[model samples]
Target: MSQQQCACPKCDCSVDSQAIEKNGQRYCCEACAIGHTDGSTDCGHNCQCGK
Candidate 1:
């Protein structure tokens, strides 16, 4: 069986699977999901860097 990995949508850190949450169609850890600094931080993906 494949294991589930919890990666932070912001920092891409290894999140504890138990602390992950599903918001809309995206998955994120509590901190990044709700704790964004005015939506800053690039998340290293392609999200607006809150500029």
Candidate 2:
């Protein structure tokens, strides 16, 4: 499969096999998948959005 950016609008992290799926959308991590609704500001990845 091809790589794609996280579903989160603020995140630019790429997702692969570790991608987190939510409602048909793929994210880099759980944080992004849930739209950081848990008060998280990052996806726990080494990316600009997570910084």
Provide the lowest-lDDT 10-residue window in model 1.
Answer: 1-10
> How many clashing pairs in candidate 1?
0
Quote each prediction's TM-score: 0.30, 0.82
Q: With candidate 2 superimposed using the best TM-score fit, by how many Å does residue 11's alpha carbon deviate from the native? A: 0.3
TM-score of 1: 0.30
Q: For residues 1-51, could you state the per-residue lDDT of candidate 1 as single tens digits?
A: 333443443354433434446554233444355555556555434543223
lDDT of 2 by residue, 4-34 (tens): 9888888988889878899999998877777
Error of 2 at 42 (Å): 1.0
Any idea what lDDT model 2 has?
0.79
Off by over 4 Å in 1: 1-9, 24-28, 35-51
Return the clash pairs for model 1, or none: none
